[model samples]
Target: MSSNEEEKLLSYNGEVLIFQLSQGDLAKEGTAKTCRLRVRRMTFNRSTSTFIQKSTGIFSMHGEYSGFEMICCSCAADFRTGINLPCVVIRRNKKKSVFKYFLLLLHSSNEFEQRMNFTLDYEMKDDIKILNGPSILWRHNRTSFYISSQNDTIVSAPVEFSSIKWAGEVENLGTILFGVGEPHSTNRESSERSSKSDYAVWGTEFYAYSVESQKILSGSYFLPHAYGSVVTCIHICATKVVNTVLRISLIALTQKNQLIWFQDGIPKNLCQLPFQDPCALQVMASDGGDLLYIVSFRSSDVCAIWKKNFQVASKWQKVKSVLVDDFVGTGTEQLLLDFKDTFNTDCLTSFKITDLVDVNYSNDAFDPMENDLFEHNLQENYSLTVQALERRLQIGLTNIQELQKHLLLKERVLSKSCKALVGLVQGKAYIPPYEEKDILVSLCGEKKQLPHSLKEKSSDTYHDSEHVIEKMWYRVLEDHLVVGVEIKNSFLSFLNDVTLSLLMDQVCTSNPPIIQCKNSVIKLDKVSFPATLSSPCETESVAKRIKLTLHNKERKNSFHDQSSDANCIQVFTVVTALSPLLAFHNFCCIVMLHARWGENSGRFGETCTVPCGKLSLSIEDISSGKYSVTLPEKNKPLKEPMEDLCTLLAVFHKFCFQITSPDCTLTSVKIWLLRHMECETVKEFPDSFLCKSLGALNGTLFSWKQKSPFEGILTVY
Candidate 1:
């Protein structure tokens, strides 16, 4: 079956996407089942947008236009439905800066249409500078204004376009102040007397900036003592003051319970909390008279504060308070409490944090094998219990097998047999079986012991060499004695000129040896003959012959001794010259020759030239201390070299061999020699060797040679 079909057959049912609930928050479907959920269908619609139904049967909407539509509610409708709802619309015109435009809009949707707006003017400069007011803000070229409501909470996420609406709310939208924050005096007497009134010191301040830059695009009014309490949030008012510039109000509270208000750097108002302890505070802008809201946490209780003056407020009032049980566990619920600080918006309705989505594993699409999941799992000791059990079972099985092997060894020793034999050679005692002798032999060769009275020789007299030889001959039976079994270094050492020339004469006389060299040929004829022997000790005869040939030219010519010094290179040439000594030996009793390079290094070459005309050659680079080659056998039997010849010769640059033969005539037989030696090395003897060994013992000798002395062939005996 195909792989896909196999997978389909193997997969089980009931997969799920699980979500976790936090704190006391609970999630329930319309049907009340809660363990797992799957996305059957999803939509974006109005009735379901931001509308969450809790397990406690309470319904809340965070924003009228922002929420995901449920998959199966059947109430899923177009998101456009929110545009026509009874919501207030506040619009403001944007003032352009170097990086961005700042505008403010605010509205309430649940009750009658309530709206608020703010207009901010700022210059394009290195650092943003405000020119006038955020009080009379405008959007779509409309000046900011608002409709009031009692029950609705106004909020928005900064990412949504409606965050502009949240920025424009004013606590008292209809009110306008004169001279920034304090009302301007119409009577001359009042203007002069106003300097003494505490209310006359009031002022408004505006802060504007793009959220991403974390920069103040503009602040029409100053924030005093900005050290401890950062500007966590800002709310711009829509109504203009008597001076025609927008009335901007700022509400800033320190962590130490001190609060201040300013208009264009002029201090207008100040207040202090009833308690001296510090608190964590968050701010969110809202609609209608409640312009800005603050959430503060003191110990285990969270408190909310709202400021209502259109310009500057002399005091702040508490709007809500709630208590929490577990401090750390309620961090998420605290997020809802502190939403205004981070986003400059508030959760319009208080939420119980119904559910939290699962903490997704990061590598959902990664391949498990590629990621080494199996290896990681194996590293976990707690997860390997089953695998550990299987490993123990395997070890137990191996122990049983070892026990069986021990029992088998005992049985084999008990059943082994004992066998023996005896013999005599020329009246001397002998052992029937000798080293290298065939283990299986007939009892017919066994001899009985002789009577003791037949002889007695003195032990001192028996110590003589002749007696030793006699004893050896008689003590070893013919079946047990191996005669003339020599271990030549390796087969290649037998190829030398002294043997090759003798063998060539035995096989051929009419022509020169047919040597193949670079597809060229050279012939030798009528050459003055010098008898040469392969034994290094035979220079006695070679010197005499050279002297004889040059007797007539002695007075006028010079002489050079060619045999005075021979290097390892010359020795290798000398050895590789003999190939026929091993030609006619027994089919199985072959010789092996071993020789090293110039410095006696371990590197050496081996060639097995068998009795039946088959030659297998191997050259090795022995730094790694191992050699192997295959020699192919066809007409006879051989395996080819196990390694390439090139690597062999590269190390053991030079080497030698030797062989012996009898005399032959050059007048009758014709001989052909075919050599196969292909090796790639810096130093190469790029020529094949072909020669024959002739004559029963001695008679006439003919030499096979190449006429060109400078090519590759080096003839040495």
Candidate 2:
């Protein structure tokens, strides 16, 4: 028989038994006393065990049995006595019988049983249509059932399906599953029978429908599958309370019995399991369907369970495996396994599917060696950099030290040179002849007169000058003036005593003279003769030497006049006695004077001259020094008219000396001459003659010449 026919037969037998008992009880209670009742007897055949009920007709069974018993409902009469009851017929005597018959066949198995057992105290107002067979899986059949919670009524709707094997709902939409034939099916007969040729491909098909609208929401299409493969079984599981959109997991069993997972009908190989002859496949959800569990049973009692989280949707993880040794059944939330222990004793265990799965799984592992090597290389590089910097720093420090040392050495040499220069300026150290020549000749040439013959003299003369200067040279040492004088017999015999005078101009008086000798004054007069002078009997001339120092004191008063012309000239004088007797005649003294007057006193090119006197003297060359004489060459006897000559003779005389130091150069000479003398014509002298002749003389000459019958100042250059 077909599967649907078998289901109907089973349902009919169950309802008939319930009908007889329920009616008999009702008659015993007198609830159907007013209604006419009819009895029917039916016999059962144990060999065939078949029964059939026709609408308002007769009851029949095949293959009679000896112990057959039948009951009548109207009067509670029993027909158990030997009767050849192959069939029985009962007609409805009243409308109640028709209603009774209707209730007998129309009641579902569960309702029938309840009525017969008197368990239902309340009557049902409406009749419920029963499903006599498994739901019909056909196209365009109104076979699907839903329950309305508002009125608790069963709703039926016609749903479209083509070659669909399973149907379910995920979230709001119902999902339909079907098999699409392989590209080249080995079973050609099945392929040719397909009414829809386009869907005859070897893959899985999924379709979605809106349950509320009773309309298809998504198309019926084949899910892409592996080459040369087809899907055999598919189970879709979703969360219980749908939110936003439903989260569903599709577990598909292919023709090869290889289980795979599908997201949106796309295949994903997520789990690995040992292949076996699969007998059944089951899927369920837990934790409000956020987690899914799948179990597959093999012929050898082998079971494998897989778990997946709907939230992640990446892959499935193998949760558990068991060799049951007996059968086991997996429920929605739990698993029941039957097994034989070591003693062959049967044991049953239940487990929660969620507890079998691990939710967090990761494969994160690293090699320790790699980390160590990287750190070592980094440390080495850092050390190398530090070492390089240290080396460069050391080199820089060495260079700096060398530079500092060089600077210090240069400073030391400079300090020593400075000390030597200071000593030369203070006359504490004697400068070498060549170095002295460099200073006196080259440097002093800027403002002072240099001796012409000294420039022509040899190195021998430089030594001779050094020794000769010990007796007659004069120098400025620091703030003191040193004078060395040599007296010869000619000077001593000509005068009993000598006087030396030093005079400075108004500007030069800023440095007042401090006499170093007890007997010396600013103007020394009638100085005693030198002790080493020659005795009167001696015909040869002997020399006597004396040295004197003139210290300069700070000026007590100032002579700088601001109202005067800045170019006004100042002259300084120094006087020495050639003969005291001749000095009285104003013709026998040497006067050394220097004029200092200019915008800059150190500049000697500009000089001022004042007209004063005229005196004629004959200049002649002498071996001792250059000498000048005013007396005529003839040796005349002393006459009273020569008194004036004596006066002149006493004032001036022929003397010779040489200047050793250029510190005594005189650009202009000043003299105090007699103002009461008769006027005379003065002869002009050339600069060349004066610079040559007068410049060669060591001692200066200061004399009184008659210019007018009155006394006046005289200046000469």
Candidate 3:
């Protein structure tokens, strides 16, 4: 037996897509039916109370000709897997007691084609909760949810992808957001002790399966004591994320018109709602994030509104909330509304709502998920190409004379280029960056800028060393540091009797800055080589100095101070005997300072230029109190683009990550790239950090790092 095959797929546009099916009386051949899918603009209406269904789209199959009988029609979608969409499931009965089903999705709203079809083996029973786009993970009365092998009717999941958790039953299933889950209830014994004991009862006794995550989140929001658990329903005005964790602000309404907010599954006094039930039938936030609009029914047929300012005095006050009825509704009608301020008023002044009772949805519209910018990555750019030789006849003198009549029609475009068109047809414009995957044929030189601090430090380290910087690749190769001399006169004299000494750490020579410096590798791995570069590395000892001390806050102990000072870089600068008496380290780049074996102070010729590594840094932390810069709230077990980023680093021996926090908080950092090593105690505010080479980093860099998918732990306290 096989059921639920993808016979059609639908693409969701901004409008809501509705599916309605009607099976007519059976004829000699078969029963007549219509699977109608339509598009409806589910928005708010102020003028009209009665709703009308417009002819947006119509996709239906009439007059069945086959022997299959329509069993039932339902909707199902597993957003965590391949596609996040509500696919229509159609069951059927074939000859000889055989069973089959079809899964249909809109082909594409943009494409004028039929819907897509997918079929899965095993028959599914109805009366199971599938409303709101969730499906039960069982067949033939809660039977086994697993299959041993892949057949023509079903595909097998990957071995590693198989989950070990049980696909247990969800008692009293209600809402279907990501997966099926047991309805909320106030049944904890602690609830008898205290009305709020339900808050402490965090359990995973509901749906253990999810398409959104490998391990379903282990938390649920049960109704508080005030809200009864008698299968009551409430309208969800809006929702908000509480933090980086999946915890959210569940703002919902009650039959008592109580506008409540549940933070992390508990009702909190987030804001003051007016005694008149807030008059917030619909709640929405402003684009600026400083104001909110609340719409509610003031009277039997009158609408009222209020504004809550968050940035200013932070008070709830009345706004333009007047609209008409609050029109009466049908059993199937849905009211959608939006807040708008056409005028440049500080607060919202207008609201529009409408009733979409008989609208439709189908895969016949453009795919919002495919064409989205952030959620679903937009499609890659593609262009048609052809050889210049193939188009030689089309570009000949004969074609120029034929285009004379249409020349005037082409002027409508503001700017047009014939060369671009020619390139498009000839395929010359789409030249790839690489000539061949394994070969390179082009050559070019670009002017590169070296850090000025290196030259300045060289002058301060050695009195006789020259301040001039030569074009050099300091640590281009494995374990080898190369220095090029401009071969100038004043520079040659400085190298003479210079005793070299390496300070190992601090970069500033004028005076020790208030901020301190520490060096440590961010992550340590014993690999043969890194992906970007391939060569035998001699500084494996440097890596050996640092153990795998991950910055895991979940660990019972505190920070690791033993390996706080990891030998990440072995850089030495040119110094002279005349320079200030400085403490040197065990291993450093051999800097040419004035030579003298016994003297504490290096003999300097009154001038030396010490080159330091170029380091760019950007950090953020609070200054007033002792706080820990923390790791981002983990998306447990890990999920994608997030999981993809981890895999990217896992595949390669080394990874360079640009960390970011949603709230934009950071503190101390330690990074050890190929040759240069940088570490320092930094804060987000009050005390700004400055690198020896790149200077003070901009706070905007925090906002800029938002693109990176990786994050690191930070701590200063």
The best candidate by TM-score is 3
lDDT of 1 at 82: 29
The parts of candidate 2 lying over 4 Å away from their true place are: 1-165, 174-205, 209-211, 217-222, 225-229, 239-248, 277-279, 283-292, 298-302, 308-334, 339-717
Indicate the worst ten consecutive residues by lDDT in candidate 3.
617-626
Tell how far residue 303 is off in model 3, in angstroms.
Answer: 9.6
User: Which sections of candidate 1 miss by over 4 Å?
Assistant: 1-207, 210-216, 220-222, 225-244, 263-265, 274-295, 302-717
Evaluate all candidate structures by whole-model CA lDDT and list the values in order: 0.25, 0.29, 0.29
lDDT, candidate 2, 147-175, per-residue tens: 32223343444433333434543444443
All models, RMSD in angstroms:
40.5, 60.9, 27.7
- Give the runs in model 3 whose Cα sits over 4 Å from its true position: 1-101, 107-209, 220-246, 252-259, 269-717
Error of 1 at 471 (Å): 99
> What would the TM-score be for candidate 3 when compared with the true structure?
0.25
Q: How many clashes show up per model? A: 58, 17, 83
What is the full ranking by TM-score, best candidate first?
A: 3, 2, 1
